[model samples]
Target: MLTKDDVRGVSAMIPTPCKEGQGGWQYEDSVDLDETARMTEQLIAAGIGSIAANGTTGECAALTLEEKLAFTRTIIEVARGRVPVFAGITTLGTKETVRQMRKFRELGVEGGFVGLPLWQTPTITNSVKFYADLAEAVPEMALMVYANPLFFKSTFPVEFWEGVGKHCPTVVTCKYVGNLMDPKNMLIDLPASMDAAPHVQFLPIDFAAPMAYDLVGDRLKGMWSTSCAMGPEPVVALQRAIDAGDKARMGEIMHDLHGLPNAIPDFKEFSKYNVQVEKIRCNAAGYIKAGPCRAPYEDLPDDWRALTVASGKAWAELCARKYR
Candidate 1:
């Protein structure tokens, strides 16, 4: 069984719920006792050992503070100590992030995965201070810095990360999710700074498993999964292969996993309809009872929902059989 410190183990980014017609995913107030319990159960059964709610994949940008509280509470309860829960501090600003980070710590969450504020609220110096100060504020829980290049202007260039790491020694990981395909993209120019980063983790959200395994695998603690979020069986198998030093097995698993990307159409191909497609697929996978999402991302048209669900159902069935 994977424990709290094994943060790199397969974890999920759950979808957020909001009130219908309010342009946000609604919370049914039933997630903790049932919905989350079910989701975590499925994930764990398939070898996943962690859960991260309220991240970008969960629509954290659209959630209210109250919703964040509710979501984290449910996730913690439902996980039932079976797997570590890393609460996402998806606050739009530094003050909110601090407050939420404190809140999750109080609730006994295992660790925190936070991103830099989206806009220009904190000066670069203040941003470093924010993380440094936050580390002091929550002395108990470990922290992981999320690197979402699309959301923040100052995501990278190693020097910045090294500076932030200096302030918060508890920050044990960096979720580097950009185009880290080429070794020089990250390691060559910033190897020294990255090596000296405060955290012990350097995880990437990449599907290019072979490239990552070959180039930067030695430096990373783990890899995040968007594709594997919905398909944990093979993902876990691949992860275990990587850990066991079974290069042949790792390549085989990677080939099977990446093939799905070719099958699932690009989000742009569906335009604004991609989210709807995603929800429908989630429903088909048994994570959600209904195919509902926030405005623009919710209530997908029936046609797209049907097609996506059909595909997802086939995939889920395949995974179930193979995993079982």
Candidate 2:
């Protein structure tokens, strides 16, 4: 079975640093990675041992195959084994994803990070088979399951994950980026993985992580922490409190954590607001290398950005201070 140390350090989802202009996602000749590298090095300096690129937050689905490879290669070069580099493979089909996994294995990937197989004809049963086929393709490397409900209609139940774990043990850790309420229910469903598979490492990765730390998480590994983006001080403080089992300090940190949701405006205009808030928060916390976002999903309207930044800065500042 994979232990927490094997897969449970903080992992940063790499943001594709976008330049505003004419075309969509066209990487101009050789990929320029200075911005991406800076973001990565910031995380490493902050104390995380590993990082992942091209996932949902990184907009993996939007990249072409060569572009994804170029993106992955940039991560590999900077990571350079300082920490294990995990790359996201977001193909819609098992065969294509399996082929991508094989390539990652050759590139010295520590494990494969696969988001749920959605945007396809899917059944929970078919989801189980999809993972099985991928595991069979790369017998040497382990796998990480990424759960994001935003993209597709398919949400695999805990039983589905248990079934996959039972069938293939190499799928070591599950990055459960689902609803915060999922833990209470999952505990009831998954009793134990059988001899055919290893115990699945359950990660409680609802974006509301520190808030869920005590309330909903008893058996979980911590989240795929976004708190890391705000610099190391607060995240490190929170992680230490969590590790020491210090409930008092944990509570203090989570106070800021609980308020994180307050940064967004309370309105139906959220899908656009979320990406905007996330980017501004990143900037306010001194984590981002660039300017306000580009278009379509571009910058928040002037009025909203001003209000959100004031709100975000306050909330983020509380973390840096309160976590201490």
Put down candidate 1 lDDT per residue, 130-199, tens digits, no spaces: 6787778776777767765555555465666667657767776666655333323533433454565735
Backbone Cα, N, C clashes tallied per candidate: 4, 1
lDDT of 2 by residue, 1-324 (tens): 233356555666556665434224344432336767777777777767557676665656545667667667777777777866668887878888988888877777767778766567567777777778877878776777775555545555656766786675567766655533343443233224222234555555434445445544444444565546656456566665665667797777666566664555554465445555665666676665433443435556777777666655765577556543
In model 2, the Cα lDDT at residue 163 comes to: 73
Q: In candidate 2, which residue pairs get closer than 3 Å at backbone N, Cα or C atoms, i.e. clash?
A: 294-298
- Please list all clashing residue pairs in model 1, or write none if there are none: 17-25, 17-26, 18-25, 18-26
Which parts of model 1 are misplaced by more than 4 Å? Answer: 1-5, 17-33, 121-126, 180-194, 261-277, 287-291, 299-311
Q: Runs in model 2 with CA error above 4 Å?
A: 1-4, 20-32, 180-198, 206-219, 266-276, 290-296, 299-308, 319-324
Please give the lDDT score for candidate 1: 0.61
lDDT of the candidates, in the order given: 0.61, 0.61
